[model samples]
Target chain A: MANIAHTVHVGLGDRAYDILIGDRLLDDAGALLAERFPGRRYGIITDDNVAKAQLPRLLASLDAAGLQHSEIVLPAGESTKSWDLLGQAVEGILAARLERGDLIIALGGGVIGDLAGFASAIARRGMGFVQMPTSLLAQVDSSVGGKTGINSPHGKNLIGAFHQPKLVLADLSTLDTLSPRQFASGYAEVVKYGLIDDEAFFFWLEENQAEIFAGGPARGEAIARCCAHKARVVLEDETELGVRALLNLGHTFGHALEKDTGYSDRLLHGEGVAVGMVLAHGFSARQGLAPSQDTGRIVAHLKKAGLPTTLAEVPGTLGSTEALMAAIAQDKKVSRGALTFILTRGIGRAFIEKNVDPKAVSSFLDDMRG
Target chain B: MANIAHTVHVGLGDRAYDILIGDRLLDDAGALLAERFPGRRYGIITDDNVAKAQLPRLLASLDAAGLQHSEIVLPAGESTKSWDLLGQAVEGILAARLERGDLIIALGGGVIGDLAGFASAIARRGMGFVQMPTSLLAQVDSSVGGKTGINSPHGKNLIGAFHQPKLVLADLSTLDTLSPRQFASGYAEVVKYGLIDDEAFFFWLEENQAEIFAGGPARGEAIARCCAHKARVVLEDETELGVRALLNLGHTFGHALEKDTGYSDRLLHGEGVAVGMVLAHGFSARQGLAPSQDTGRIVAHLKKAGLPTTLAEVPGTLGSTEALMAAIAQDKKVSRGALTFILTRGIGRAFIEKNVDPKAVSSFLDDMRG
Candidate 1:
């Protein structure tokens, strides 16, 4: 079995925990969780989509490890992350009689991980949660970070908590079940690490796009490498207080697209982010902070991966340049009237620019259509 | 101005914070918050009751401190802590453009504190929050604990996060505006410290019940002392792992009473705890864990302080012994088949009992009615 490992410091003093990634880490979850949570109660939160395909293996692994557990399956999708649905999850936890020392395992993708982490955070004033990412998106991103929450009408992940998982088991085998679209969406987040801080990695992605997108051992290695980068950055800035904000390179533009599309399957997170990165690069170039060729390279690479690199390529998308800027203003990244945009001086060097003007961003969006 | 002080350690290694209490602490909330969170984006969440009585002075203080802030005044009461209301609070915070460094001040009692703290914990995956507690209950209890959440119809505080505040400013002078009932309710949590592990303090309260209930400098000192004790306990065990369970001494029975009373004004938290403590003492005596005289002292002290010490006195209350046990099972505290009841051997010495049979608890509750 292939082995991969990384660490995420939750910045919570003694309460901080780490995430461990590997091929068969599910077999090790019981031990890791038992170390942090010295109790008997264990509850697993997942969605039907995940439960049907992934829950049995998870249960079998836990059972083989001599750990007892119970499971609850939520309906699949973004709506499951609602405040109403969060209450249902909490009820399920309380109904299971979980205590402060027990653990809740999030056994699905981002939706389950976010909601379960949040439920664990609040269940008994803060208990323990384990993230068992069964999807590429969760494995590379959400599962490692302490950010967990549900969506509000005003925005996605509008209501949530910075609750780190006690342990993260990103079983690479789980990704095998992902559809092409799902796999590609996760690749978008993996590419994010390169865009944010690793120029060499960005170049590597450009060089190895075909191999990684085709899905194999090379893709797994790329996934692990990106997670390692993210984990290191997260440990240094757990609360997104400083360099961690760099991780939001494409998220500001991406969140708007997701919001505009009502977070539908038509515009998967990765697709939105793929297009978002192109826009970010274009905006950075328009501001004279990045080389113009950098924008073309990013778009070309995304297109080669069968991902949408421009807004027009995504069907049923809406928003004028003005609307997108207004949505960006609503982004958590913007402080005061100035937006903190992550721009690349070139492929390898990403920096935060707090002096970026919205009119420049709007103008860039206008140019993207041209 | 009277001086009141209590410190809380968040256990974030060197980043731990203390909650300082004083007569005019709220008068300089903006400055204290700024010291912890050096940003201008702040959103003050208050209720109509607090808005009318406290917002003007708070806003003046923020202005005098040269801080930037916006305010949202929600309707007062438990109803305001619902998901719908919390959704609106999130909208208000987003509307004000709160960022990770920005602070959201929970500027009222528990209801406002819970909702605002939850909103802060979830808004953009967590922002900074300062607890400016204006009520006796919040000052001595909820505000310092980092247990921020809202109540759902399924259960109380089932959805929340243990998001520690950046700072807590408990201005004791605000107690002057509390109704007598409100003041009495706050006193119940203060007595909890003594009942749980401080026999000397329990005896002290027994002797000084009159002075504490009178709402004076002595009362302020008692409140601070309780807060200090609680803070120290929380610092060592923030997540309620072990010793922290003792803090729930009277809460099991108290929660049942509050639920039975529909959490209305008919039974305030402390008053319910007063009755719960009496029942707990009676149950302990029956179990031969404590002397019967200890139960008498608990009831006598509560009576002298004008607090209820019997179930008959709890208005609108319902529950047979079985119902009470069922509610306890529903409590977020249960582990496995064992309930970790904080049973006192006597005043000041309490321990967890895993073998407290629910049948015995039911019988004890039935016997207590006699």
Candidate 2:
């Protein structure tokens, strides 16, 4: 009866869905899915890591309920988001003979969710999917926005679709399996919600930080709050056409840093974001757009959480300013050859700047290099 | 100006767009596009064949209007709708640095339209695109529906997205270059609109078939009529949850035969569809669901248009009933493992028939082989 802990609904008209967060939700997944999506066969798309740790629980649940399903396990890594793996995932879905009416269950973190969700988007000309995010970064960010895609050689997430999921199940207990670094990396995104436009939430997180990290009751509340904030922004601009760009507060810079590292362990996605968030704040202060103290406070907060707060902290030798600038120009946010970025006025007061100057960006990166 | 002929509006709320059918449209593409989508850069995706025949006209038009654009040309044929080509197209667009503010011009027949349109749908997580269909098959059928996709080894159009274009320009003069066989092959889809729900249009085609074939005034009228009919269906069921299934009246049977033929010249798509349409009627008649003579009438019309209306007329070996059944089961139209098909009661009276018996379909194919 207590399988559920908290729930957030994403109201996108007919495309709207619910997000459930709990400790033992995976144990009751069979009943949960059966009650929500009746008569639909499931195609569970997961990564190798999640398959060993999490797939069996979901499979056991479905089997116990006598619900029909198939599984597609791919290599687990940022590199898995490619045209080759995308084709394999889709071909597997087709080989399983899952109809458009059947549902695709994306059962992993951002990489698997983005790949599987994009596969579902194009398979049979778009199928419904549900996200079962096992990582904190995914549960708070990628899984909610319906922004599903794979990375191109040109850049990360340069090819994809805005395909929303029918539901999202975030099992709180699964967080136990993540390495300490992975957990901290995902926490960077949780911090992003507060930095985007919620000063009050940022203050609240500072207070509840230790408990959330310790797996206290505050952990569930923190995730729910992040989801609710994201749900509000997504509801306002589902397509990233306007207000939704706010969600990319640190992503534009984060992506360039990721590409600089060849998207490797030298910097995890969230680690890149932790540094990028600091850079974003520092750049805003340099532009006289915000108080310098706010940027300093953010650096301290992220540093205390065991997250990298500067480019110098990235293990590998950093790429040149020119190379990083080239990556930024190639990012999907460019408009009419002008750089578009999420620049902030202060903590929780981010805004979309469409006419960003590339020279300014290069200069900022140059100064940050020291 | 005599540059334009007819325009059909597909109203899907904010996603609505116009389908323009006319003579000299390709020559006028630059001006037309400049007027409709100002400030957006363009990426023209076409086939090598179309690049030779019609690409110059479009480029000259854009040049005259002072528009910026890039090109990506692939080999011509159904095989170009593979994952490899799709990757090439998306990479080309990204390499061209076409941002979300830009637009992709799908400038060729169904193969290019489906491939490029799909690329645009996924590139940068959904950019704008315009369809400039040259071949009759694309102009009359594929261009208007927003059902863009590529084929899988398993089946035709098994991978794709329902991404609507900003606008669709079916250049009538381009059809003049089509081989007579190719032209007739496209006429099958024109006849399909009439058969789907418009008995009067079917009769009209029967009466004016000669003039339409001769490229008379009736040709433009026929194409416009088909576009209008498709527009209505798409507006009502953009994602095809219900009535949209009617559009697949002959697709189930057609797809199996196409797969059997390796999607080659052994049986062009329209030829397979012609035979499929006849089989649908014949099967309906055998089941006491339709008038037997209607099947005969359809065969006569299709034959006169130089389309194959029987399996024996196909250029290569016909697979056994079991093989064809296997392909049919693998098609995207199957529902809950039951044979779901567009089975009609009579002409212009198609209905979605779920729970269709696969054994009956197998035996029916056995009878049709004779």
Candidate 3:
């Protein structure tokens, strides 16, 4: 009924899917779901945190569409993204007697989406999953990629399969429930779009920093735009074989920061990502590829949006570039000996570069202390 | 270079792969691997049992191909197909710095193939995997299908993904190490081809049982023929959408029997299937679909091959039809409200029937006690 029409294409041959974004999109869920999951049964996977807030609306929409559904709630956060939790969730789905054609609706943030997606990938030797993202971070990044997996004791997402979601539904209306800090944390990924590609969008965010930080329908639109950009890159390279690594622009550094805190609640993903992006830009400037003014502007924009923009600002964060390099090597983005670094020549344009010298990165780390 | 040129076709559109059968196929491992792997740093996964007996030849072949490889030897057995073992294997692969385009080689019997294939499927969001099946069961079944997974405390293959191998090498030479019992166990599946389809093959086995049971070059040819037949069926319908379910001729009963015995080595998979085939045929006869003589003849063949063909012979087996039915419901093969029963009109014409009355199945179970 609303003037809603937006799509994010994930490139994975026939396995590729679309992420549909717009206002009141949840209301139109039935038609879109019927197009993919024409089965009688639909299984919804959410977290306790999300089910309390958004389950009612999703159910009402599906009910209106005459879809029979069951729900399973998981614990919230990265802690629940374990193999044990994944197995438990799968057992719950199995209990519901979900057939091969049944849909696994991942209704929550990234953690819920990742776990549910991974579960569906293995359940019945691969089934269909739909991503219903409720957080800014999930809406922009995770909900689109087919990279599904759970964490192992050795590392995060160490155990998982490549399961693509049949569709992704990002209700702009869902972003209404957010603390200012959480909202800003998601904006970090929004800024990533510019640092990786699309300098124009980065410039647009630069101009609308105040309005974007205000958190409303406008901010939600901005988030959707960023997700659309991500979906395009993913569709081009579903497995991160080539250009998809660019999407991890700030993730290599971000993961290390998250790991340093043992992936605790001290720093949310986007907060770490914000800091990592600034540092990446700073490193680019040190390499004489990016202007210092551009790096300062990027840092200022993130700071103004209430996001952290420096390693110094992150307390209890590890400082060794060697440690960071080691972490980077462990990152999913590394291909052979070459590391795919998404860097900026300026705010409006991002490029993926390989064989980035770790010594130069170390030099950048040396300058950070001074 | 030996004449190794047989291929099994798993039908999944573009995701389909081939299983090649012959001798010294490992010599062309490079050319085959280059088509799929095409990169440096491959992960060679085998078990302690396989490593001691066969890993050298595989490594030597890789060396001849000028391929750089690393090896991870897991402890052998069904017990090792746990999350703890998978975690250790993934960590070992990561420690070796294996990347996205790099490959993982599953070299051993069914246990090693399933575990390693599953590991490759999840590691870094799915990498290339080569199936160098060293056991008869692995060659004809597990190696051809993309059904990669690990066993859980709850059930076998409760946790897994559909990650197909890039290429499969089912060298007949590997069968030389099988003990007579092991060789007989594999023969059970070989007999399955006749019970499910191809009456000619069943009659052929009837005439050639002595020669084939000798586990010589002729046995390899027979095994290859069976794999080729299965490959065509798999290629036509990779997901078991319809006709594929017929392949599970005795698996429903066999899997439950295995579960009853705690999936221990006491009852080899092939032996369990042998008894299961007899039970399934007996049930079919009770349903008036086939004559009792069919069941008698099938059971006689299994007994002649030294395979278990009766419930009383099952080691530590217990419980009622209801318990076996419950386990059947938990099977990845079950869909809707009924078990997918693979029953024959007679020898060599199996079909999958849905919604068969459970009470009839219960009565058939009661008859098995006699």
Judging by TM-score against the true structure, name the best candidate: 2
Error of 3 at B308 (Å): 1.5
Q: Who wins the lDDT comparison?
A: 2
In candidate 1, stretches whose alpha carbon ends up further than 4 angstroms from where it belongs are: A1-39, A59-67, B1-39, B64-66
Model 3 agreement with the true structure over A1-370: per-residue lDDT tens digits = 5335566566667786777777767777876686666765789999998888889888898998889999998888889888678878887777777877788899988889889998898876777889988888888888877777776554567667767788888887777786777778888888888777687888888887777666545666687688778768776776666787777777777887787666777788899899888877887777788898988888888888888887777777464767667776677777678776777676756677878877777677667755
Candidate 1 structure quality by residue, lDDT tens digits, A124-194: 66777888998888988888878888876666776677777777778777887899888888888888888
Write the residue-wise lDDT of candidate 2 on B250-334 in tens digits: 8899989999999887788888888888888888888899998888888898989999888888887888999999998998888
List pairs with backbone clashes in candidate 1: A160-B122, A199-A348, B4-B21, B199-B348
Please give the ranking of all candidate structures by lDDT, highest first, separated by commas.
2, 3, 1
Q: Residue pairs in steric clash, candidate 2? A: A197-A348
* Reference-based lDDT, each prediction: 0.79, 0.90, 0.79
lDDT of 1 at A264: 81
Misplaced by over 4 Å in model 3 are: A1-39, A56-70, A152-155, A317-319, B2-18, B23-39, B60-67
Provide the global lDDT of candidate 1 against the true structure: 0.79
Per-residue lDDT of B231 in model 1: 76
Please give the lDDT score at residue B170 for candidate 2: 87
Q: Which is better, 2 or 3, measured by TM-score?
A: 2
lDDT, residue B222, model 3:
81
Docking class of 1: medium
Ranking by DockQ: 2, 1, 3
